[model samples]
Target: MPPRTIGEEFTKGLWHENPIFRQLLGMCPTLAVTNAVINGIAMGLATTFVLIFSSIVVSSIKKLIPNQVRIASYIVVIATFVTMADRFLAAFFPLISKDLGPYVPLIVVNCIILGRQEAFSSKNSVGRSFIDALGMSAGFILALLILSSIREILGAGTFLGHQFLGSWFEPWVIMILPPGAFITLGILIALTFVIEHKIKQRR
Candidate 1:
């Protein structure tokens, strides 16, 4: 592998280090709200906001926090952002917020967000941390979008509440169920590995 440039850091999470397919972090919301496209998108954006801001803040204040208490400090920072995001969504997007349920509050403990803070942000410069956050958030959102699109279209025969399939097409009730979430995610993960392997072979 070549030495990584700053650009690589920002772009790798799109596929190479995707939080869902690669790292397999934050499975709670990934599986819980992905029954519908709108719910998935709402959860993704809310998580993105929390992840980015928390990374920025954690990186900026890393030095000031003691090693023993760094994890606690990081949680506080993450929780603050999560609270803000939760309230913001509730205020403006009540319907989506309701649909998302407790998953939004659960972002404070999401492994993807806290993992980056502990592994990257706590040691890196603010700029690098921000880029990492951006990449991770983008990857997360993309994963949610793809998963939700597959689920909603097949399960409900709709895309964001708009019917896409003709009357001839019957909805797959299983696609909207828990088993469907696992099955879809499993297939996507396998497909991701195959693509990555092919790319590696090409190189």
Candidate 2:
């Protein structure tokens, strides 16, 4: 198999293997905390920190870990970074921390993070794993931003807590609820499929 270029490694995560839109990996956080843009951004960054660090650690120590215990080791490495991210958010951004609640700690089990470690990092170079992690993180963040922006705008008539829609706009209270997340995510995923199909046909 040919080695992937750095660009290929990074860009694939943006769309082709996007954790949310494409692979549909991290739905819990994607749906739970994305009613507001700030929460989405905070969750994205925190997840990014854990994913990147865990990938690097897994890549670095892959050879030392026995096959029988590799999965457990990966979880431990991932958990260490998750703890750091959780503590940092709580200490520096109390409100966002409170908003995120258990989701931040839940990063330890996020398939996007663990799947990458198992599928790519364990067998790849540290640098390659880092790039893959970075790409995946960017994709995750972008997904959250798109979902949160639409939700916030229609649900609360605001973007990132700043009102963009005027008095004429009536907020759709349902857009900020659990049903809203499902509805918005479903639409976005459907649109993504249509766009990808069009692009493939054009080729």
Candidate 3:
């Protein structure tokens, strides 16, 4: 295999290999906290912090870890950043922290973060790992934003808590529910597949 350019590394996660839309990783937080835009953003940022730092640490120390314990070691590294992110949110952004609840701490087990550490970061250079993590983070955040925005707007007729629709518009109460998450995610995933197919056909 040839070396990947930085642009290729970064852009892949945005679309080609997006964590949610394409890869379908991290569905727990993706579905749970995305009823509101703010919650989605908070989750996205927390996951980003954990993923980036964990990737860098794992990439930097991959050689020292034994294969048998690499998964455990990666968890510890991911948990450390997860703790910091959780603490920071709890200390300052208490409201959002409360809203996110356990999902923030559960970042320790997020497949996207752990998968990158094991698959990409462990074998790649620090710079490449960072880029991969960043791209993946961007993808995750983008997914959350899209899901939350659709949910929030359709469910509450608002964006980021501000009303977008007037009195005539009735919010779909179901959009904020669990079924809504599934429905919205399903549609988005289908759209992504169609878009990718079109792009492929064009080529």
Candidate 4:
């Protein structure tokens, strides 16, 4: 691989170092909001917004902060964004915000955001950090979509609330449960590794 450029930093977030499927960070939201497809998308987007803004701010001011207090500063930055995202969702989409519950605010604690700040934003330029954040957000959303699609269709016989299963088909109760989320995500994670491994071998 060539030395990474600015674009690569952001683009890599989408696929290479995806927070969910690639690194398995923020598993709680990955499983919790994924009970329904809509919820999954909402949670993903909310996180994306927070991640992008936080990265931009953190990277921009990286040089100003002392190393000892950097972690605390990052948390404050992340928490601010989380609050903004949470309030926006509640104001515009009360129903979704309600469904997501405190998990929305918990975005502040999501390892993916903090990890990016400590690992990437602390050293990168603002533009690079923006791209990196966007890419990671994309990766997170992709994973959420895959997981939620499976759960929604299987658990409720619906796709984004539209019935896909005919009347004759009964929904699998387990697919909507917390255990189901864990088992399904585990399988998906395993599959992701298997597929990636094969691609690597072929190359």
- How do the predictions measure up, each by TM-score? 0.97, 0.98, 0.98, 0.96
Per residue, candidate 3 scores C-alpha lDDT tens digits across 122-188 of 9999999999999999999999999999999999999999988997989999999999999999999
RMSD for each of the candidates: 1.1, 0.8, 0.7, 1.2
Clashing pairs in 1: none
lDDT of 4 by residue, 1-203 (tens): 78688777767876668788788899989989899999999999999999999999999999999999999999999999999999999999999999999999999999999999999899988888888888899899989999999999999999999989998879998999998899899998888899889999999
Which 10-residue window of candidate 1 scores lowest in summed lDDT? 1-10
lDDT of each: 0.94, 0.96, 0.95, 0.92
Query: 48-109 in candidate 1: lDDT tens per residue?
Result: 89999999999999999999999999999999999999999999999988888899899988
Worst 10-residue lDDT window for candidate 3 reads 162-171
Ranking by TM-score: 3, 2, 1, 4
The true-versus-predicted C-alpha distance at residue 5 of model 4, in Å, is 3.4
Q: Between prediction 2 and prediction 4, which has the larger TM-score?
A: 2
